[model samples]
Target: MNQHKKGLVVWIGIVLLLLAGALLAGPGDRVETVQETMRDAVLHNVNRISLLGLKEVNPGLISAFLVTIILLIAAALIRIFAVPRFRYIPGKLQLLLEQAVGLFDNMARGASPHRFRFVGAYIFAAGAFIFVGTLFELLGIQVVTVGGHPITLPAPLSDVNAAIALGTLSYLVILSGGVAANGVKGVGKTLKEFSLPISMSFRLFGALLSGLLVTELVYYYVNLSFVLPVVVGVLFTLLHAVIQTYVLTMLTSMYYGEVSEPSPPKPKKKKQASSPAEHA
Candidate 1:
C-alpha cells in the first residue's frame, strides 16, 4: 500500500512538472502573479452576465461545458461502437471496471438491496461528471474566471460545467424525492443525501484551485531553481488529484450505502369476522 501511494505521488510530481513547465516560465517579467490573475478573474467575473437570445456565452464556462459534453459523447460512442467482444480490450480494463462495480454493488447490497439501483445511478452520474472535469483540466479549459477588471457571470442556463450541473441536479432529486417520500420529515435526510455529491465536487475544485494558486505563488516569489518547482508543484497537484478521487469514491459508497437500506414491510390489516362467516 505504501509503495503504491508513493508511486502515485511520483506520478503526480511528473504531471505537475509538465503542467508548470507549460503554464509558468522563468524569473522573467513575463510571469504573472497569482494575485494579478485572481484579481483579473474576480473583477471580470462577478455577478455581471451577458445574454444573447436566450443563450448565455461565457467563454471559460462554455469551454469547460463543451469539452465535458464532447468527452461524454466520446465515452458513449466508445462504449457503443468501439468496445468489442471479449477479444477487444485486454483483460485489465474490463476486469477493473467489473471488479469496481461488483465491489460497489456488494457494499450497497449490504446496506439495502432495494437501494442499490439508486446508489449505482448516482455513482454513474457523479463519475461521468468528474471524468468531464478531469478532461477539462487536461485540456486547459478555465472553468472559473478569476481576474479581468469587472467580474461577470456567464449564461446561467446554457454554460454550466458538469460538476455544477450534476451537483444541482442531485440536490433537486434528493429534495423532491425526500419530500415525496416522507414530506417535511425527510428534508434533513434528503439534504444529507444531496451533500455527498455537492461536497465531492467542491472538495475537488477547492483542492485543485489551491494547488494552482500555490504553484503560481511559488513561481512568482521563491524564484526556485530548476526541478524544485517541478517537484513541489507535482506534489501538490497530485495530492489534490488523489484526494479528490478518494473523496468522490467515498461519497459514492456512502450514497450507495444509504439508498440500499431496506424499508420495513407494512403490515396487512386483519379482516373482521362476520359471526363466524354466517356458519359457513
Candidate 2:
C-alpha cells in the first residue's frame, strides 16, 4: 500500500512539473491558424511531387508507392528465407503466418463457399494492404515536398484517389468472379449494385481521414501536445486499421459470393396427358 501511494505521488509530481513547463513555454512561431491547420489536413498544401514527368502529385501517392514497395520486399524476403524451413510442429513465426492466412481462408469459405479460392486470395491481399497501409503513418517517415516543406507521409487510404482506386479494383474483382461463374447473367447481377464502389471508396477515405484529422488537431495546440497526441493518434490509427480492413474484406467477400452464385436449373415442363375422348 505504501509503495502504491509513493508511486502515485511520484507520477503526480512529474505530471505537475510537465504541466508547469508547458505553461511557461511560448507558442514558437506558429503562423498558421486553427482553420489553416484543419484546411491543410483536408486539402494538403501544394506539396506535390513530380513522377515520370507528371507534376503536382499528392504525397499520399508517394506513401502508397512506399507501402507497396515495402510489402513486396517483405514478401520476397519471406518467400526466399522462410517457406523452406516449415516444420510439422510449428514455430512462432510459422504459427503466426498460418493463423493470419487461415483467418481469411475461413472467412472466404464461409462467405463464398462455391468459389472461395480466388476470393480468399483477393481478400487476404486487400486486407493486408489496408491494415499495413493505415499503420504506415505511425512510422512518421517524412518526405520533402516540391515546395521544400518536410511533411510526414500520410496513410494511402486517407487520400480520396487511393481509396477510390482500391474500391474500384475490389469491385472489378467481384465482377470478374461473377462473370466467371455466371457469364452475362452475372454481369447483369453485378451491374445492379452500381453504388458499391462509391460507398466503399468513401467509407475507407472517411475512416482514415478522421484519424488523420484528429491527430493533426491534437498536435496543433501547444498545451495538449505533451503526451495526449501520441495516445490519441496511436489508438485512432490502430482502431481504424483493424476495423477498416475487416469491413472491406468482409464486404468484398460477401458481395463476391452473392454475385458468383450459379443459377439454378429451370424445371422441366410436364407433358399434358391426352383426354379420354381423344384417346377413344
Candidate 3:
C-alpha cells in the first residue's frame, strides 16, 4: 500500500482495537426502553402556570430560555463588536451572518413574492431558533433534577410542549402575515387551515423525539455506549436539526405565501357598440 493508505489503515486498526477493548470491558447494564429514555424529568417545581398548573418547571423551557438568552447575547455582541469591526473585505463571521440573512431573505421572497416583506424577518427568526434549539443538547450543559440527579439538558423541541409552542407560534406568525397582507380576508384564510398548528407541533415533536430516543437507547446499553454513543447522538441530532429546520421554515413560508396572495381582479365586460337594430 501507498504511504497515505498505510497511515489510514493504521489509524483505522487503532480505533477498532480501542473500541473492542472498551466494549469488552464495559459493565453490562440493562438498557432503558424508548419511553423511559424519552420522558423529561422535573428539575424543580416553580410557580403555578394557572393554565395547566402541573407545578414542575419544565427543563425544556429552562433550556429554551437559556438558548434564547444565548441568541440575544450573541446578537448584541455581534451588533456591538462584529458589526463595528466589519471592514470592506468582510471578515468570516460578518460574511457568514450576511450570507445567512441573504439566504433566508431569498427563501422568504421565493415563498411569498408579494407578501414576503411582511414575514421575512419572522421566517428568519424562526429558522434560527429551530436550528440552534435543536443542537442545544450537544452543549452538554447539565441541570440538577428535583431528585438530585444531574443530567445533560435535552433540546427544547424534544419536549412535546415546547414543540407544540413552536409549531403554534409559527402558525401565528403565518396568520399575522396573512392579516398584514389581506386584513380580515387574511384572517379568514389563515383560520381556514385549523389543523395547521396541531400538525406542525406534532411533526416537530415526533422528529426530535425520534432522535432523542435513538440516542438514549444507544447510551442505555453498556456495550453499545463505548464509542457508539457519540456517533449515534451526533448523527441523530444533526440530522434532525437540519431536517426539522428546513421543514418548518418551508412550511411556514409556503402557508404565508398562500394566505397573503392577493385575489385576481375579475375581467371587465366589453362595452361593445349598440346593435344596429337597437340603434334603429
Tell me the alpha-carbon RMSD of every candidate.
9.4, 3.0, 5.1
lDDT of each: 0.51, 0.88, 0.79
Weakest ten-residue segment in model 1 by summed lDDT:
151-160
TM-score for candidate 1, residues paired by index: 0.56
For each candidate, what TM-score against the reference?
0.56, 0.89, 0.81
In candidate 1, stretches whose alpha carbon ends up further than 4 angstroms from where it belongs are: 1-33, 40-60, 87-90, 99-112, 141-165, 173-188, 191-201, 218-225, 232-235, 252-256, 259-280
Which regions of candidate 3 deviate over 4 angstroms? 1-21, 24-35, 39-55, 266-280
Give candidate 3's error at residue 44 in angstroms.
12
Ranking by TM-score: 2, 3, 1
Give the better candidate number (2 or 3) by lDDT.
2
Best by lDDT: 2
**lDDT of candidate 1 at residue 276, scale 0 to 100:** 69
Q: Write the per-residue lDDT of candidate 3 for residues 1-280, one digit (tens) a residue.
A: 6999999999999989888987788765433344554453211132112223454556677778888999999999999989988888988998999988887888889999988865678878878888899899888888765555566777888777888898999899889888888899899999999999999999998888777777766766656876677777787688778889889988999999999898677899999999999988
Candidate 2 lDDT tens digits, 18-94: 98887788576775678886776666655566555676788788889889999989888878888798889999988
The better candidate by lDDT, 1 or 2, is 2
Model 2 residue-pair collision total: 0
TM for candidate 2 is 0.89
